[model samples]
Target: MMKLASLGLFVFDASTFPFSDLNRRRDWRYGAAPRIGDRDATQYLGPGDELVTLTGALVPEAGARYGSIKTLATMADQGEAYPFVDGSGVVWGSFIILSMDERRRALLVDGTPRMIDFTVELRRVA
Candidate 1:
């Protein structure tokens, strides 16, 4: 319903929807990658910064949703890692753009990154 472009650093939100039907097997999140414990906590995202699973939206003051968000599994990364890092040395997880119609400006949620055996292409832009 919405067209989404990478905000360079995975800065996504409800307003950020893909232009195409992102309902594919690959587009869903399989799991997260293993992270190092020594990494600085300041560099990682806080629970508030990331979307959380909520039951209902009673408090209108906060951006709480009235639905439950499912937790994704954390699969392993056996191959080369993505070039981007969240300042924690832990690589940013990858998601396959199912039916990603680059020319038509449409993208679908394909399969998990590990299932398809591909890497998420994250880059830094100035």
Candidate 2:
């Protein structure tokens, strides 16, 4: 099995689930002071905020499991930080789940989703 990345206990792989898109954002904080008849002076404060967004689809017919989404929701409810790690053995940092959105499509006879598209947003806490 090929592994892509992992957020705490949730793993991303072909047999389980995989994220198609991974976006990371990093921002720096700065403060500007107005000067009389001159250019404003800007002072660099420090690192502002960092965020990561993962988007993917889960298809049960293709070996994806639906319970993974529920596990993520449970983790989010705990309001704790989890370590984010990539398959390449890179530790991104500790992050907390900011939000999770899921859209069910192609429903089955029992109203279960055949295909589920999901987005998970995380904010770096440390």
Candidate 3:
């Protein structure tokens, strides 16, 4: 269970385990695919620039609890380094928030925030 600095990005979904997808994929695949299983070349061994991509979701209604989602969702203006820590308090990496999903929106009766869910894509800083 890694935590991002975004606040409540995890833990909002009582039915889902937020940090379940804390994993990285390091590979470079460049080829021309004429068919689904056909590749002209399959040689991809890159250091990935010593960076790992971390993907997680802010709980639905994250904005309501954490304030306006715009605070973090405004990616073009909020390109900053955020700390990424694992459940054991290990500094895994500094992640850069790539983009913000509008956090799925909905029209409700109680007038809760429209944004219910948002996903974050980040690259680990080396």
Candidate 4:
């Protein structure tokens, strides 16, 4: 929903709507061995990892929101990380941009991006 830029200089509001395929996957690592005549034995390791991925697009709100998404997409392309906060003010931690896609018809006649469809894979970094 919103992100605080570094140094608190400004905030980039990238509000997205019609969020699709939003999900979270949590996993753990373990060691398992099969027994000869029985089932199997498992050993617990430790905490594994978590990641959240989703596909969504920016609505045609106004200029500033659209402009900020362009900036974020550029930063995402360079493997930059940012705190992805939702409209509920929940901080999703540092997330690296895995992928971004834009529809060709999303651009306005003035050359500004009106709507952007993107799919991003966000890994949670403690």
> Which candidate's lDDT is highest?
2
Residue 46 Cα positional deviation in candidate 4, in Å, after optimal superposition: 2.3
Task: List ranges where model 4 is wrong by over 4 Å.
Answer: 1-21, 61-64, 77-93, 106-114
Give the alpha carbon lDDT tens digit for every residue of 1-126 in model 4. Answer: 444222112243444234446677878889899999997899999757777666666666643344545665667667656676654666666667665555534667887766666665666665
Each prediction's TM-score against the native? 0.16, 0.95, 0.49, 0.61
Off-target runs (Cα >4 Å) in candidate 1 are 1-8, 12-17, 26-100, 104-126
- lDDT string for model 1 (1-126, tens) is 221333223322232221222211212223345568864334433222111111111221233221211101111122222232232344434432211111111223662121111112221211
Best by TM-score: 2
| lDDT for each residue of candidate 3 in 1-126, tens digit (9 for 90 to 100) | 233323224331223324324455444545443657765655555545334433444454432343434555653366667665655556656667665554444657886545455455567655
Q: What is the lDDT of candidate 1?
A: 0.24
* Model 4 poorest ten-residue lDDT run: 4-13
Taken over the whole model, the C-alpha lDDT of each candidate is 0.24, 0.91, 0.47, 0.59
Could you tally the backbone clashes for each prediction?
A: 16, 0, 3, 0
